[model samples]
Target chain A: MSWITDEMRGIVGKVMREAVSHPIALSDIRKWAMAVYWPEPLPRQYWDEDYAAQFGGIVAPEDFNPFAWMAAKPTPDDPPVSMSAFRESELGVETPDYKAILLTEIRARHGAPMRPGDVIRCVWKISDYMEREGRMGLMLYTTLS
Target chain B: MGDPRTLAVGDEIPAFSREGTVHHWNRFAAVNYEFAGHHWDDDVARHEGFPAPFAMAPLLHAYLHAMLRQWAGPSARIAAVGIRLRSPFLKGCSMTAGGRITAVRTKAGETVAELELWMDDDTGARLSTGTATVAFPS
Candidate 1:
């Protein structure tokens, strides 16, 4: 799908202007964004590869999908209730049932390539979301959440 | 199989640090579609409460991912990563990414490590701080 439609772009432009003055609360936006971005939890098929790489000697760059994890959302066809079940299956654990939306890092850059004053609008949409159970523990899944 | 017990609590993962500049920031913005004029436009940043155009937040996160891969080598699973933004990352400013292991625990027979991270500017002023958990092999 074309991500840059006139309507979408217009909305993005409006948000850019308003973000400074009428900035949406991060939590609120995150909820909506999470609904689309991280619909549920990390899947076992995906997590297993990622888990193996971290604790075991297995390593593959393709195993990690930070962007996918942050941008995916559930489709209309997905059962909302199934999200929980999907997450538990991915972690392979039962306790703690970790459910958190964490913002982990920020790296400031200097001498940016764009002109020093150009305004850029960032518009993110959710692509998929679900839940999964893995080997680690009870994981409340949300790919981007 | 490598003895799972071989892993120790005091093990230190060497911190990987890198310097970033405006050129890098622009590249990140261009890719991420961060057309915010303040990101690369000096006048706009000043008008918008930033000293200069700053790097994109995602770029910062990507850098952290890179740092993790460098330190943990290829075998590292990022269980969860999060960051809270603080000061502006103005253009012409250089940033350094650093972190240290804070705790380690295993759940479901998996070894997970927690680390505290700091993304700072050239003068050592902190721009962001966060904790991340990752599972690594025994």
Candidate 2:
């Protein structure tokens, strides 16, 4: 049986959620670098401003996620956005039930570096969907970007 | 390995490794704000049919980027990174991420190196594999 539904396919390119982050902070970058490289000293560019000055200034680790927590667009007063994806209900589409959701892959493309005082805006959408047979059973994977 | 400008295909770059411990995962959760129960609670994990709580997928992806940054130096631009998770890096395991140069070419004013990346746990299981591109100024 196919997991893909007409509604799910129709909203593939539509925006499901959008968020704008508050200005990024230096501590935010420092703490992220520290967390990613715990027990070891991170590169100076991530922690020390003077050392980072050689490259311009401090920049967040390229893989940093700005939408990890709260966002300005989806104000704190607004209902929470579930961490899990495939919630087409939010976009007025019904979703098929599944036992568990697993993140199978991640692809990131970088252009400009994220630095302190930078405000970031994110638009979340369901880019694609596919089903594969696995050990558990028929698994449906949704690609959100 | 001195200037990144002389990088050649088949060169294995430095790696970033870390044990699967809450000591480190908690820190990542703090910054990333990922408080998913399955990541730290064995019971929650078992309920999901996993052997044990495992490392978050994003953290594994970040480790690959961390390895790239270590080798590319502060100035090199990491153009892109893509990873496919094959197995969970369960708690108590050790993950080491490394990559080898696959292709190198010049673009505009930068030299970009394409790499084949892999993450293997100490248990000899390949946890994830993917590719990346890092560009260094010429």
Top of the candidates by lDDT = 2
What is the lDDT, from 0 to 100, of the residue A39 in candidate 1? 23
Model 2: which residue pairs collide? Answer: none
Cα misplacement distance, residue B86 of candidate 2 (Å): 0.6
- Interface RMSD after interface superposition, each candidate: 14.7, 1.2
For model 2, the superposed segments whose C-alpha errors exceed 4 Å read: A83-86
For all candidates in order, the CA lDDT equals: 0.45, 0.86
DockQ of 1: 0.08
Return the lDDT, model 1, position A64: 23
lDDT of 2 by residue, B108-137 (tens): 998989999999999999999999999998
CA displacement after TM-score superposition, residue A7 of candidate 1 (Å): 21
Docking quality level of the chain pair in candidate 2: medium
User: What local lDDT score does residue B38 receive in model 1, on the 0 to 100 scale?
Assistant: 62
The C-alpha stretches of model 1 lying farther than 4 A from their native spots are: A1-145, B1-12
